[model samples]
Target: MSYMEENLEKYADPEMYDHLHEGYEVDLKTILKWAKQDGPIVELACGTGRLTIPMAQKGFRMIKMDIK
Candidate 1:
Protein backbone atom coordinates (compact mmCIF):
# COMPACT_ATOMS: atom_id res chain seq x y z
CA MET A 1 0.00 0.00 0.00
CA SER A 2 1.00 3.57 -0.40
CA TYR A 3 2.10 5.50 2.69
CA MET A 4 -1.14 7.50 2.67
CA GLU A 5 -3.22 4.37 2.31
CA GLU A 6 -1.39 2.75 5.23
CA ASN A 7 -2.05 5.83 7.37
CA LEU A 8 -5.73 6.09 6.44
CA GLU A 9 -6.90 4.71 9.75
CA LYS A 10 -5.29 7.53 11.65
CA TYR A 11 -7.21 10.06 9.57
CA ALA A 12 -10.39 8.04 9.94
CA ASP A 13 -10.43 8.18 13.73
CA PRO A 14 -13.24 10.69 14.18
CA GLU A 15 -12.66 11.51 17.84
CA MET A 16 -8.89 11.77 17.52
CA TYR A 17 -9.06 13.79 14.32
CA ASP A 18 -11.74 16.10 15.70
CA HIS A 19 -9.70 16.76 18.82
CA LEU A 20 -6.61 17.42 16.80
CA HIS A 21 -8.56 19.84 14.61
CA GLU A 22 -10.33 21.57 17.44
CA GLY A 23 -10.67 25.05 16.07
CA TYR A 24 -9.84 24.29 12.49
CA GLU A 25 -13.41 24.37 11.29
CA VAL A 26 -13.63 28.13 11.06
CA ASP A 27 -15.33 28.17 7.70
CA LEU A 28 -18.87 27.44 8.79
CA LYS A 29 -20.42 30.73 7.71
CA THR A 30 -18.25 30.96 4.65
CA ILE A 31 -19.16 27.48 3.50
CA LEU A 32 -22.80 28.03 4.25
CA LYS A 33 -22.86 31.24 2.31
CA TRP A 34 -21.21 29.68 -0.67
CA ALA A 35 -23.36 26.58 -0.59
CA LYS A 36 -26.41 28.77 -0.41
CA GLN A 37 -25.46 30.47 -3.62
CA ASP A 38 -23.80 27.56 -5.39
CA GLY A 39 -25.14 24.06 -5.70
CA PRO A 40 -24.16 20.90 -3.78
CA ILE A 41 -20.70 20.50 -2.35
CA VAL A 42 -18.18 17.70 -2.52
CA GLU A 43 -15.79 17.49 0.37
CA LEU A 44 -12.71 15.33 0.09
CA ALA A 45 -11.18 13.87 3.24
CA CYS A 46 -14.30 14.86 5.13
CA GLY A 47 -13.04 13.67 8.48
CA THR A 48 -15.65 13.28 11.21
CA GLY A 49 -18.18 15.34 9.25
CA ARG A 50 -16.94 18.33 11.16
CA LEU A 51 -18.06 20.89 8.59
CA THR A 52 -20.17 18.61 6.47
CA ILE A 53 -22.81 17.98 9.14
CA PRO A 54 -23.27 21.65 9.84
CA MET A 55 -23.46 22.49 6.17
CA ALA A 56 -26.08 19.83 5.63
CA GLN A 57 -27.94 21.08 8.64
CA LYS A 58 -28.06 24.46 7.00
CA GLY A 59 -29.86 22.88 4.05
CA PHE A 60 -26.95 22.30 1.74
CA ARG A 61 -26.50 19.03 -0.08
CA MET A 62 -23.00 17.68 0.48
CA ILE A 63 -21.17 14.61 -0.68
CA LYS A 64 -18.45 13.69 1.79
CA MET A 65 -15.66 11.31 0.80
CA ASP A 66 -12.59 10.04 2.56
CA ILE A 67 -9.87 7.43 2.32
CA LYS A 68 -11.62 5.43 4.96
Candidate 2:
Protein backbone atom coordinates (compact mmCIF):
# COMPACT_ATOMS: atom_id res chain seq x y z
CA MET A 1 0.00 0.00 0.00
CA SER A 2 0.98 3.60 -0.44
CA TYR A 3 2.26 5.66 2.48
CA MET A 4 -0.92 7.76 2.52
CA GLU A 5 -3.13 4.69 2.67
CA GLU A 6 -0.99 3.20 5.41
CA ASN A 7 -1.21 6.38 7.43
CA LEU A 8 -4.97 6.59 7.01
CA GLU A 9 -5.40 3.02 8.18
CA LYS A 10 -3.13 3.60 11.12
CA TYR A 11 -5.01 6.67 12.29
CA ALA A 12 -8.52 5.80 11.19
CA ASP A 13 -9.93 5.98 14.71
CA PRO A 14 -9.87 9.46 16.19
CA GLU A 15 -10.43 8.25 19.74
CA MET A 16 -7.56 5.81 19.56
CA TYR A 17 -5.31 8.42 17.97
CA ASP A 18 -6.14 10.85 20.75
CA HIS A 19 -5.50 8.22 23.38
CA LEU A 20 -2.17 7.31 21.88
CA HIS A 21 -1.11 10.95 21.66
CA GLU A 22 -2.44 12.00 25.02
CA GLY A 23 -0.32 14.18 27.31
CA TYR A 24 1.69 15.37 24.34
CA GLU A 25 2.37 18.95 25.30
CA VAL A 26 5.91 19.39 24.15
CA ASP A 27 4.95 21.89 21.44
CA LEU A 28 2.19 23.72 23.28
CA LYS A 29 4.50 26.03 25.15
CA THR A 30 6.55 26.85 22.08
CA ILE A 31 3.49 27.48 19.94
CA LEU A 32 1.96 29.74 22.55
CA LYS A 33 5.17 31.64 23.09
CA TRP A 34 5.77 32.36 19.41
CA ALA A 35 2.25 32.63 18.05
CA LYS A 36 0.88 36.10 17.60
CA GLN A 37 -1.79 36.83 20.21
CA ASP A 38 -3.60 39.59 18.37
CA GLY A 39 -5.51 37.54 15.81
CA PRO A 40 -6.05 34.52 13.60
CA ILE A 41 -3.74 31.52 13.50
CA VAL A 42 -3.86 28.69 11.01
CA GLU A 43 -2.82 25.24 12.14
CA LEU A 44 -2.20 22.63 9.50
CA ALA A 45 -2.70 18.96 10.43
CA CYS A 46 -4.52 20.06 13.56
CA GLY A 47 -5.57 16.63 14.78
CA THR A 48 -8.83 16.97 16.73
CA GLY A 49 -7.86 20.54 17.60
CA ARG A 50 -5.74 19.36 20.52
CA LEU A 51 -3.72 22.54 20.54
CA THR A 52 -6.18 24.67 18.62
CA ILE A 53 -8.80 24.56 21.37
CA PRO A 54 -6.45 25.88 24.03
CA MET A 55 -5.21 28.62 21.76
CA ALA A 56 -8.80 29.57 21.02
CA GLN A 57 -9.53 29.71 24.75
CA LYS A 58 -6.65 32.10 25.03
CA GLY A 59 -8.62 34.32 22.57
CA PHE A 60 -6.94 33.37 19.33
CA ARG A 61 -8.99 32.97 16.19
CA MET A 62 -7.83 29.54 15.14
CA ILE A 63 -8.21 28.08 11.68
CA LYS A 64 -7.62 24.34 11.84
CA MET A 65 -7.27 21.81 9.07
CA ASP A 66 -6.61 18.07 9.16
CA ILE A 67 -6.66 15.10 6.82
CA LYS A 68 -9.06 12.63 8.43
Candidate 3:
Protein backbone atom coordinates (compact mmCIF):
# COMPACT_ATOMS: atom_id res chain seq x y z
CA MET A 1 0.00 0.00 0.00
CA SER A 2 0.98 3.60 -0.45
CA TYR A 3 2.37 5.25 2.69
CA MET A 4 -0.71 7.34 3.26
CA GLU A 5 -3.01 4.41 2.73
CA GLU A 6 -0.99 2.29 5.12
CA ASN A 7 -1.20 4.91 7.82
CA LEU A 8 -4.92 5.40 7.23
CA GLU A 9 -5.44 1.68 7.52
CA LYS A 10 -3.68 1.70 10.87
CA TYR A 11 -6.24 4.17 12.13
CA ALA A 12 -9.25 2.50 10.55
CA ASP A 13 -11.02 2.46 13.86
CA PRO A 14 -12.75 5.84 13.85
CA GLU A 15 -13.67 5.78 17.50
CA MET A 16 -10.11 5.10 18.55
CA TYR A 17 -8.63 7.63 16.16
CA ASP A 18 -11.12 10.25 17.20
CA HIS A 19 -10.44 9.63 20.84
CA LEU A 20 -6.70 9.95 20.34
CA HIS A 21 -6.85 12.93 18.05
CA GLU A 22 -9.66 14.82 19.65
CA GLY A 23 -7.25 16.37 22.14
CA TYR A 24 -5.36 17.98 19.28
CA GLU A 25 -8.47 19.78 18.16
CA VAL A 26 -8.20 23.52 17.91
CA ASP A 27 -9.38 25.59 20.81
CA LEU A 28 -12.51 27.46 19.83
CA LYS A 29 -11.35 30.67 21.48
CA THR A 30 -8.07 30.69 19.59
CA ILE A 31 -9.84 30.04 16.35
CA LEU A 32 -12.30 32.81 17.07
CA LYS A 33 -9.46 35.30 17.40
CA TRP A 34 -8.02 34.36 14.04
CA ALA A 35 -11.47 34.24 12.51
CA LYS A 36 -12.01 37.78 13.68
CA GLN A 37 -9.26 38.78 11.29
CA ASP A 38 -9.86 39.35 7.57
CA GLY A 39 -6.99 37.31 6.19
CA PRO A 40 -7.48 33.82 4.84
CA ILE A 41 -6.19 30.88 6.91
CA VAL A 42 -4.46 28.02 5.20
CA GLU A 43 -3.55 24.67 6.76
CA LEU A 44 -1.03 22.94 4.55
CA ALA A 45 -0.66 19.21 5.23
CA CYS A 46 -3.84 19.60 7.25
CA GLY A 47 -4.03 15.92 8.25
CA THR A 48 -7.74 15.20 8.87
CA GLY A 49 -8.71 18.83 9.51
CA ARG A 50 -9.21 18.31 13.24
CA LEU A 51 -8.37 21.96 13.55
CA THR A 52 -9.60 23.22 10.23
CA ILE A 53 -13.21 22.12 10.62
CA PRO A 54 -13.57 23.69 14.03
CA MET A 55 -12.12 26.95 12.78
CA ALA A 56 -14.54 26.80 9.87
CA GLN A 57 -17.38 26.19 12.27
CA LYS A 58 -16.46 29.45 14.00
CA GLY A 59 -16.81 31.25 10.63
CA PHE A 60 -13.10 31.24 9.83
CA ARG A 61 -12.17 31.07 6.16
CA MET A 62 -9.78 28.13 6.24
CA ILE A 63 -8.31 26.32 3.29
CA LYS A 64 -7.13 22.78 4.11
CA MET A 65 -4.74 21.00 1.76
CA ASP A 66 -3.05 17.66 2.23
CA ILE A 67 -0.81 15.65 -0.09
CA LYS A 68 0.00 11.98 -0.06
Off by over 4 Å in 2: none
Cα lDDT of model 3 by residue, 10-62, tens digit: 45665676678777645655656645548778888566677778788767788
- For residues 4-39, could you state the per-residue lDDT of candidate 1 as single tens digits? 678775675678878987877668767665566267
| lDDT minimum window of 10 residues, candidate 3 | 25-34
Better of 1 and 3 by TM-score: 1
Give the Cα-based TM-score of candidate 1 against the true structure.
0.66
Give the per-residue lDDT digits (tens) of candidate 2, residues 33-56. Answer: 899977789999887888999889
Give the whole-model CA lDDT for all candidates, comma-separated. Answer: 0.77, 0.87, 0.71
Model 3 root-mean-square deviation: 4.0
Which 10-residue span in candidate 2 carries the lowest summed lDDT? 4-13
Per-prediction TM-score to the true structure, in the order listed: 0.66, 0.85, 0.55
Q: Candidate 3, which segments miss by more than 4 Å at Cα?
A: 1-17, 26-36
Candidate rank order under TM-score: 2, 1, 3
Specify the highest-lDDT model's number: 2
